[model samples]
Target: MRVQNLVVGFGPQNDTDPVLNGVSFEVAPGECLALVGESGSGKSVTARSLLGLAGDNAWVRADELSLAGNDVRGLSEQSWRRRRGRDVGLVLQDALVSLDPLRPVGREIADSLRLHTRLGAAARHARVLEVLARVGLSDAGNSVRKRAGELSGGQRQRALIAAAIALDPPLLIADEPTTALDVTVQAQILELLTGLKRAGTGILLISHDLAVVGRIADRIAVLSEGRIVEQGPAHAILTRPEHPVTRQMLAAIPVDKPRGLRLSPRAAAPVSPAAAPFLALSDRADPVAPRNTVLEATGLVKRFTRPDGTEQLAVDGVSFRLERGTTLGIVGESGSGKTTTARLALALTRPDAGEVRVLGQPFSAASEKERRLLRPRLGAVYQDALSSFDPRLSVEQVLRDAVGGGRTGRGAASASAATAATAATAATAATASAADRLRVLALLDAVGLPQGLLGRRPLSLSGGQRQRVSIARALASGPQILICDEPVSSLDVTVQAQVLDLLDELQRNLGLSLLFISHDLGVIQHVSDQVAVMLDGRIVETGATARVFAAPEHPYTQTLLGAVPRIRF
Candidate 1:
């Protein structure tokens, strides 16, 4: 596959403002060529142009574009469709959105075979199972019957790969394929792609992660602002980078960096005193002691009923303590009970056999009325921030609602004094409304957002901006503890670096205890003072982050460390 002087624009008027401007690259047979860049840097646009999947408004122009020695410059939609599954296969990043939700996964795979090959129904069914097993889904019999939503993140990604390779296409395009996968599962996916490369298939790999690219790429091309800044062998570009953009991206990685050091350029500046006051909780007046356990769980157990009418233990005998003003990182693969343990910590889910205590008060075992007063002191940030927000509400409304919800004293007045009570209620409402507005603006400032975004909805904001708003909402309650579940997993490296630095600074200024959960071990090492390694619904290992990573005792922990991709430089 070759692309020379490729240019793609949104509309006819955007000829000079093309999304991909003069981008050129080549993928040889039995080779993997990586395209590395941040978000909106034309990586996805370039991939789409090759497959003729660029939108209707796109004006695509190239001096030379060919796949398998055949020109694909001006192919009609029907012609491109005919060549898609037979000659090229595209494995998108999000499998949950890529695959049909209502259809069985097996049927999704069979449809590709039915479209590109002349196979009977029975033969296609057999091939579906074979392909599923090939992609490491060994229990293809059960996986074939389940829908895409029923599978875990890794399983769904593997299912997407299985369908893409069912026809054995010679050219493959994978776009951010391992963005949110665990280190172990990402290693498996990388191995599968490598196997395809060894089988004489040319691959175009698009990703923002330089570590993953260094592991599999034979050649690398760095893209910035719709142009290729550098292209050469993988080793030279990673180790001895020539372009300033390449160097900046390498420096932004938080793998080996220590805590209290800034990962991004923006984080070097001092935190504003005005912003500090908004993030600080009442506990900031007291000095934080190392032994103060702010959140703790003992002998926690959670179970779920599967589709087969069998019980599955999601969390089993899990116990941990989070100290005040420190971060406790949880590392695990998908379905390892990290998320369930987080829910238990947040009191979002109840445990069947254990109890949770927040600041020496009963949390998980307490009734709703008993826990309501204490709930304002805890906040949570989820992986997908866009889904967590209300689509109809503006940024100001979201923060105001959170601030109002945290106040629990508004409804305590008696109903006996009718006229006087009504006048008092009116005055109180006016005062609270004025206070809420000020708090909302302060929350935005604490999260480093501009006041211009107050009127915009969440869907209109960028990924980084949405995450910042999510953090602002979490801080609206003046919480002493913050729970972040895969907060930066889906962001690009530069943006991820800024968010991590922000969280570090917030912890310092607010005296906040953090329960940080992620599958990326490098992030765990950078942000966590203590780390817990989980596997199969239990904590297998726990220790100081430096000690645990430097000398892992458990075999599973060792395996996980070994699988992590590293940039040699």
Candidate 2:
């Protein structure tokens, strides 16, 4: 497979700016060619153009585009559809959004066979199970019946890959396929791709993760704006990054940084001591003896009944403590109860048996009334912020809602004055509106967002921008403790670095405690002071971040760390 002088643009007008400006690359048989670039750098557009799926608005043109010695420069949609599954397989980035939410996993995989093969129902079903097992989803009996939502993020990703490779296509175009996976699962997925490459399947790998590309990619193409600024062997590009953009991306990785240091260009400045505390819940309490422990949990146990009516323990005998102004990173593979533990810590889910204490107060056993009172101090940032956010609401409204009923009370008071003094009431409403606007501005500044985005909704913003908005929302209520669940898993490395830096800066400036949960050990090691390795619903190892990473005590912890691909350069 090869491409030369590929160009793509929207609208019929040739004068319009093109997304891909003469971009060219190739993937020969048994070789993996990676296209590395930041968001909006035409990587996805280039991949979609090959399959004639760049949407109606796109106009694709290439001087030469051939696969398996067959020209495909300007194929019709119907022709491209016929060739898609038989010639090229596509594994998209976000499996959750890509896979059909309403259909069973088996049906989704079988759709590919139905499109490109003449296999009957029984044979297709059997083939689906075989492909699922081939992609490391061995529990095809159960996984086939389950919906995409029922599986973990990594499992969903594998299902997508299975569907892509179900017909055994010669070319595989994987666009950030492992973006949302944890380190261990990512390693497994890369190994699977490597096997496909060895099997003579040419792979066009598109990603922003250099480490992932460095692991399995044979050649590298560093894209900046709309062009490939550097292209060479993977080792040469990684070790000697000739392009400045590539160097910038390499420097943004979290592994090279120390704890409590800023990775963003805008360094954190000390907030005024007299400034109104935002998300500082513990400080408002009556002065007492200084306590180091901010959050603690012991003997936490949660059980769920499976579809087969079998009880499964999700979190068992989990205990840990988080000090004030510190981060505790929980690392583990998919379905290992890491997310369940995070939910339990935030009291988002009730544990069957356990005790949770937050800021020296009983939390897990607290009544609804008690929990409601304590809710103001607790905030959370989820992996998918767009799902958590209200699509109809603008960024400004989202932040204002996080401000809570206080703003509503002000509006109510202003309305009450309308009957007495119309002019004065108008003035009061204006004042209240200005105050709310100022508060929203402050939150945006803290999260490093431009004031221009206040009117935009979540859909209008990019993935990284939505995450920043989520972080701003989390900080709006002035919470003492924040729980971040895979906050940067779906983000590119450059954006991820900024978010990590922002969290560390916020913790230092506001003295907020963090419960950081992720599958990426490199991220955990950078942002966390203490680390806890969870496996099979239990804490397999716990220690200081540096100590554990330097010399892991448990084999599981060592294995998790070892799976993380290092950029030797």
TM-score against truth, every candidate: 0.93, 0.90
Candidate 1 Cα errors over 4 Å, as ranges? 14-16, 122-126, 268-270, 285-291, 406-430
Clashing pairs in 1: none
Candidate 2 wrongly placed segments (more than 4 Å): 100-133, 139-155, 266-285, 288-290, 405-433
- Candidate 1, residues 1-569, lDDT tens digits: the string is 98899989987754458888999988899999999998988999998999999999888999999989999999999999988877888999999999999999999999989988899999999999999998898699999999999998889999999998899888999999999899998998999899889999889999998899888999999999999999999999999999988887888888878877888877522347766655568444534322589898899999999988999999999999999889999999989999999999888888988999888788999998988877877999999999998888888888887877835222222244334657878668667777777777888877788899999999999898899999888988788899999999989998898888888877887788999999999899999999999999999999999999999999999999998888875
What lDDT tens digits, residue by residue, belong to model 2 across residues 389-443? 8899888888877764345532223445655677867787667676666667777
* CA error at residue 112 for candidate 1, angstroms: 2.6
RMSD of each: 3.6, 3.1
- Number of the top-ranking candidate, with TM-score as the measure: 1
Instruction: Give the Cα RMSD of candidate 1.
Output: 3.6
